[model samples]
Target: MTLLVGVDIGNSTTEACLAECGPDGPRYLGGALTSTSGVKGTADNVPGVVKVVQEALSAAGRDQHELAAVLVNEATPVISGLAMETITETVITESTMIGHNPDTPAGAGLGTGTTVAFAELGACAPGERVICVAGAGVDFEDAAAGIAAARDRGVEVTGAVVQADDANLIVNRLPTPIPVVDEVTLVEKVPLGMPAAVEVAEPGRTVRTLSNSYGIATLFDLDPDQTRLVAPVARALVGNRSAVVVRTPSGDVADRRIPAGTLTLIGEHARLPVGVDAGAEEIMATLRRVTPLADATGEAGTHVGGMLATVRDAMAETLSDTGGEQDAAIQDVLAVDTFVPQRVTGALAGEFALENAVALAAMVRTSRAPMEALAGQLRSALDVDVHVGGVEADMAVLGALTTPGTRRPLAVLDLGGGSTDAALATGDGEVHSVHLAGAGDLVTKLIDSELGLDNRDVAEDIKKNPLAKAESFFHVRMEDGTARFFDEPLPAEAFARVVVLGEGGMRPVPTRHPLEKVRRVRRSAKHKVFVVNALRALERVAPGGNLREIGFVVVLGGSALDFEIPDMIAEAVAAAGVVCGTGNVRGSEGPRNAVATGLVDEHAGRTR
Candidate 1:
């Protein structure tokens, strides 16, 4: 019997699978997965590679020396970048809107009054309701004290908008509780003496009055035409716990459409020009018009230009680091149009309006120098014969063939973190593959932007784990239409709201979005990346871009292991009258460690 280890370094994860081979071929032993230390094919990945190998060895109850050989995948590293352009611009000359999610807003209910500076609040006439403005220069203590003194003098300070991260701090010290919205970055720009509305909801609730256009219209006594102009302001404040909107007569907010800019796709025959505003379908249609892209450039001084430049520079630097002085030119770029719900500048209600953006990942084909360097490092550390495996797609197809009921003339979609790779194998054993960007990381960015989570880690958790809403103390309703009962009561934060299934435990999501809404966003993001990429990849390998021409499709790599993704993709692929399912590596390991398992199987003959 021969014991061997296979390692596959992905953009986000590092995996190792162990197998024992004899005359009967190969038998599955064990596998382990961990976060990749850094970019794949780089020396920084060695530590994570060693960790996963050691874990698989421990699981198999085998000594490191007992392993005959170690094979690491020849990873095609990709560099991903994100760029945002605000599609909707509101230019309210005098009225400033503040709409953002501050973790700790204070008190509840709406307060409408004239805007007044904190220092001048005492000088205001009695009985006139005033909304105090506190700039960043004012501490929470002084702001609270000033408001209290003004109130004692019979001046009604109905509400307050502050610049510091002290909304809860000032509210707790107030003589009588009033709504306090804090963390306004442009507090100094807030127009004093203008009519304003401040609304703060109770804990775990979102402000309603400010989120509705009709509500703002009634409060401000605006005409229909004027109310229509304020609709964007209301939309931006939809999910915030607290908000403040000031009315400036000259303030006319217009939703100015920013040109996302044009992209120049250089092809062998001709160059195609597409605008970012044209959407993904149009951008991709333009790409299809040009079979093989030589290089892509964005118009200078535009968002797309900045975005493309960023990706190229990053890939060039990474390649230079690995290959030493070699000019790293980006061979190809994949662009996906996505949106980001970004907070508006000088917004009074902390509002976040949806902004148009592009997500891109650039690929630079590299030589075997990096792989050789990694092999040298591993040999010095593990004291084993390290070999760089065959092409990643070829090994994956070979491993995918181990799945029950799968055979030649099939296609495999290696949906990984950085890229979606598809390979087609003819009945006689010839394979053709294409690697493109926009995969798991792109989905994570979409989730983060749409939900306005502002935290990539949380967005990733939301993407990978099943979502549920805590309905009662004893049970939580899961996204799969099932309820999980707990023997002990859940934490208060997890009650009556959506929560993400985190490694530590059930963690509550702060947004006011319902469970179904969050689930919809998550699924939509997956569709945008995986489903779209699957068809795009297969079309390149099939004749006339007809998916029906392909017989079967087996999904490999880490993403195929997602709970709902495989079934979703399978259903979609079946529409083309083609059979599709997640690969079961070696008939035991399901949809994971394909490249790693394939490495061992492909190396078996050499060992013999």
Candidate 2:
């Protein structure tokens, strides 16, 4: 019997399958997986490949010297890079709005008056309507006393903006309740003597008057042009429980569309140019117009240009030693429409506005020289015969066919970390495949950026696990609205907080967003990446770009292991009359080890 090992080097991991070939066929012995040492399809992967192979051989109780050959898939180095360009920005020339959700504000009504400093409240003439501005140095008790004394003199204290967290204290001491907005970090920046309006909502409610443009217009008696400019301020104030809109002589808010630059799609048939500001849908539509993309370029000295250059440069640096004649070229691009929370240009408090952005994920493809170079390195390291195996997609399809209830004319979706690959196999032994950018990593990034988590690890955990709100020490409300009871008490930090139910136990989400909001963002990010890429890949592989032509689709790779990704894809493809589900390779390995197993099966066929 001859012992052989097949290795599949993926973007994020390296997998190996060990098998023995006998008179009848090859019997699978064992398999092993480890993180890829370096970027896929490069010589840096030698160390990881060696480690995985040794593990597989050791698990199968075979010595390295007994191995006949080590076969590796024909890996086309695919590197995916992401960039986000903010198309719309909200810029306030003057400090016109303080729209932040302070945990505790006072009163529940609208108050409008001329802004007056706390020290000047005593000098205000009787019946003069004014809003009190308390500095941090003033105590809440003293400020309340001063306001009460001014009111006793007939000075109308319509509202108050406090530098400290004393809104509740001040309002409780006042005989007549008035709206009070507190926690104004940059109180000094508030324009004095200007007309301002403060509105506070009751508990468990959001501010209404200040959140509407018409409401602000009526308060300030703004003209048509002035009202148009304040629309962005109103938008920024939405969902806040308390807000303060100060109208200065030169206060201006502008929602401007930035010139993010253009992208040139180089295809086999035509070259199309698309503006980054045109949004994601337009860019993707232009990409579809030019199928079989050869390369993509961006305008010089522009955001899109810098983004594309960065992706190209990264790939070139990794493939510098591969001795390839051509430089790295962008083979595919995936554009996603998303919102990024950007700090308002001019605001008293650190308020953020959700700005429209287009996130692009580009896939760089290098020649086979890199894989050949890697093969030589592997041969030297292992001192065993190393052969570059068949096309990766074909091998994956072959491995997927081993799954029960699978047969000819089957399609496979290899959803990995960096790219989404699709392969269609027919009875005549012909395989059609396409590789596209954007997969699990992109989804994680989207979740990270959209939710403003700024942490990939936390976003990944949220992507992989279900979320829950800790209702009590012993019970938690799950994302699906079901209650889960724990025998032991939960962590104190998780009480009344949104937590992720991962294998390592409950991890509290650091964001102040509620459980439902986080869950919505997570699911939306998944749907945008996996479900969209699945359909895009299938259409390119299916005959005449018709998904209906494909009968069965077997999902493979790391992303297939996600709890909700497979179901989302299945639901999406069902509309086209396609049966889709996660693949259980060999009826034992679930959605994994397909490419490695296929490499072994192909070798066994050739030897026979």
Candidate 3:
């Protein structure tokens, strides 16, 4: 048997796990969790990690040499990617050119040739034949719903489709075969029928077909020429010089004209689409294959910001000169997320792929295809033999485990400052992780925002636990369900006063409720949002069909230490029918040490 150590270096805490791996697989020996020494993802990482490692070894009564090897992931000396997109104008003509995505703000439909109305589309004048237009009267969601309503009810709907940027996605929901033009400024000009079609430049040519009797017949079931002046409307529709024409409604299309109406293009909006998602699978894929976030932001971002072809050449050079043999493995593996930030803004004729950029940037685990390209580029940059597996923060400890959980799968959620990372590990080596934007720091931000307290440190305290006023005396109730009444009441001046006396310069609060109720509400409110979101994230990762299926879960990192946060979540999870407990990294500390312990576990491999 060989002894291995896993060191998990985190932003606020560090943990180490010791394990022995042999013929029977890996077995856990002892572990140590401690406060981290310094900021993570910096040159200071090694020292903090070393401290955790020593603690773990001391617990096991062993030395570092007893360890067989060491392994590290994107944690500790954290490495990643970043990219910025700024455009002068993201909106352009043709929102429905298969790229527009008008979400929610507008209803779904392909409407054309109607007079403009001052009122918004949702509230149209009865039979005014006027187009509804309202500023701030609707949102992208509103538009999408309206369009959808029109299409589902088979109404003649048309207009310049507006979306919250993802025009193509909105376009996808519209009635097929109906021309739902997106991105236009002049929606009113689109003529109604032949009487409206007269503006067409070419009355005799196909331009006239736009507002012609045939056009009306195509868009609506209107009898041929109810009004004789329709010649002009048709002329305006299919204008000479390569004009796009809405096909006339077919008599058999819907067994009748589909609430026939003209199709018009308006609003300058871009489309953004989120491709197939596989949660946070791409995080590992990225560290294994894409360029580091530092590299991208430091210098690589500049390179990719320019001509994409330049990025292509740079990728080739980096790969050929440095990637070596791991190229194939890195290139072949796929991550699970694909995101498109704000779609096409111009008349982009051909495909403008982000594959090469994503490969080079390799920051977050976004999507499958983009991640694959990132993998290829990553292989070319690194000389080390890298393998993509396990959670970034919790895996190190798990790797040292010798006995499988009596349960088939377990969830480990590591809450950090910048991001909240939760992973569900299947005994079979398959892991699903969810990396959300909010975590410890975000909690502070929320507290600050909620309390109207601009103080970061105060917000931090509120986030870690709950707060209550000292009331009549200088005493206050703690969130752990305890109260401390002071001997003397606080001076009114101390309300917002920063008293440097407390461990964290805490200030007194004035509340309408008793100290106990205030503490309870604060703690309860935080948990309601954070715990619920975390559980939902975990549920999405677990292969188990329901919350009850998850037999066990471990909570780690700074946020977990919230005097009542862990218990709050425990109760919440239990309510969902699962057995859950706060993490005991090495039998002492709770949520603070998973990262450091994980580091040791990662290097030591299957400790059990």
Best by lDDT: 2
Ranking by lDDT: 2, 1, 3
Superposed by TM-score, candidate 3 places the C-alpha of residue 472 at a distance from the truth, in angstroms, of: 4.4
Off by over 4 Å in 2: 321-325
Over the stretch 1-608, how does candidate 2's per-residue lDDT look in tens digits? 99999999987889999999987889999899999997677788999999999999999899999999999998845667777778889898988899988888998899999999999998999998899999879898998899999999999899999999999999999999899999999998999999999999999989899999999999999899899989988988999999999998988888888878999999999999999988888988999999889899999998889888877776667666555565567889999999998888987888888998888899977666467789999999999999897999889999999999888788999998888999999778899998899999889988998888899889999999999999999999998999999999998988999999998888999888888899999999899888989999999999888988888899999999999999999999999998799999888889999999999999999999
lDDT of the structure predicted as candidate 3: 0.42
Could you estimate the TM-score for every candidate?
Answer: 0.78, 0.96, 0.43
2 or 3: which has the higher lDDT?
Answer: 2
Each prediction's RMSD to truth? 5.8, 1.7, 19.3
- The TM-score-based order of candidates, best leading, equals 2, 1, 3
- Model 3 misplacement above 4 A: 1-3, 18-44, 55-68, 74-406, 427-429, 472-521, 586-589, 595-608
Model 1 lDDT-worst window of ten: 78-87
Model 2 / residue 229 / CA error / Å: 1.7
* Candidate 3 per-residue lDDT over residues 1-608, each given as its tens digit: 87665555555666666677776655667776666554443334455656666777788888765666444445422212222122111232331112211112233323444533223444443333322222233454555566555445544444432212434454455555223333333333332231111111212332343434465555444555432333323332332311223222220111111111111111123111111121223332343333211122112233223312343333334333322331211111111212222333432221111111121112133211122232333233322222233346346335322223324467776656645566776777666666543345444444443344457675555555445444334665454546566666666756533221244545654222344543543554455345754665576566754766556777766676666767777878877666666676545545544543455445444444
Q: List the residue pairs that clash in candidate 2.
A: none
Quick one: best TM-score, which candidate? 2
